[model samples]
Target: MSAKALIFYGGWEGHEPEACAAIVEEMLQAEGFDVRSEAGVAVLGEADLARFDLIVPMCTQVSIDQVPLERLCTAIEAGTGLAGFHGGMGDTFRDAPAYQFMAGGQWVAHPGDILDYRVEIAQPQHPLMEGIDDFEYRSEQYFLHVDPGNEVLATTTFDGSHAPWIAGTVMPVVWTRRHGRGRVFYSALGHQASEFTNPQMREILRRGLVWASRTTDSRETGT
Candidate 1:
């Protein structure tokens, strides 16, 4: 049977929530996942979440209620993978502490318009990054406030656009972290559908989903 994936998208329409969800759903389906897509958080239920092996949220700048937020966190902690990119994942739920904790990072700022920037692969040996080389793309350079404990998968040197003074600093653009028994993967690359549709970006996301669904227990305990 194909692995199941669920995508919840909504909040600010300007970010193309529905379109983003469609893109993600299509990509996962192409990879043999039984994907489901929804446009809002309202469709999510505790039972609905428990049935999926992966969850992707394409929401932007929105708040989720405490009840559903806790439910989602619980699901991840039980080993359901969570993955997403850009405002859809990082810029979401700015007010909720639990939501922020589950995502492992929060979007704080993006200085310039979509401009040419370089992404440096930090973990070339990691399964998600393996076979991928550093590349440059013309897109928004996200300046994020990331968790200190996250396993950084990719980074970019700050350019002078947002703050010229901080040009030399390396900022994380993609990362993963363990949230209890589950895995979390996030990439700050997709500012729009055009960017997300890039071949490199699609491959990165595909590998990330597979990596996020792997369990250490299954590897060790053979369960």
Candidate 2:
């Protein structure tokens, strides 16, 4: 059966959330996911939130109601996969520690803002990164507070142009971590939807979503 997936987008329009949502929705549909799209966190509050196999957050810098926040995190813990990219996931739900704990990271700053940088594949032999080579990208190089438990797959180094102290600092640009029974995958790519045009960026997202959505254990647990 096709995996059930929900994508909610809104918050700061500068992130091009709507376009990112549309791009991801199309990607999921093409991958045979039964995709549902919404404009805010409202759908996360649904009584049967656990029904989806995958939950994608495209909303950046938004506040969700307490119950919905708990339900969303609980659903993930119960085996609903969560996958997202860049600020859409990395910089969202600023006030909620639970959300960050579940998602595995939070954006702190992009010292130099948009610029050219190279993404080095940290785990070259990993299946998710198979055939993927380190690539140069021009966008916001995220400096984040990340979960050390995460299996970092890609990294980027800060050159100290914008922030001298952080120069030579290696930061995670892509990672995966488990939250209870769920798989959580994130990539510090996609400042806007157009970044999806890059084959490497597009493929990482495709692989990340597929990897995150296996919820057989959740179904078996009945949680």
Q: Which candidate should be chosen as best, given lDDT against the real structure?
A: 2
Location of the lowest summed lDDT over 10 successive residues in candidate 1:
214-223
Model 1, global lDDT: 0.81
Error of 2 at 82 (Å): 0.3
Segments in model 1 whose C-alpha atoms lie over 4 Å from true places: 214-223
Check candidate 2 and list the clashing pairs: none
lDDT of 1 by residue, 95-197 (tens): 9878788888898877787689999999888767878999987788888888899999899998676788877889999898889888899999888877775
**On a 0 to 1 TM-score scale, where does candidate 2 land against the true structure?**
0.95
Off by over 4 Å in 2: 215-223
lDDT of 2 by residue, 135-200 (tens): 999999999999999999999999999999999999999999889988899999999878999999
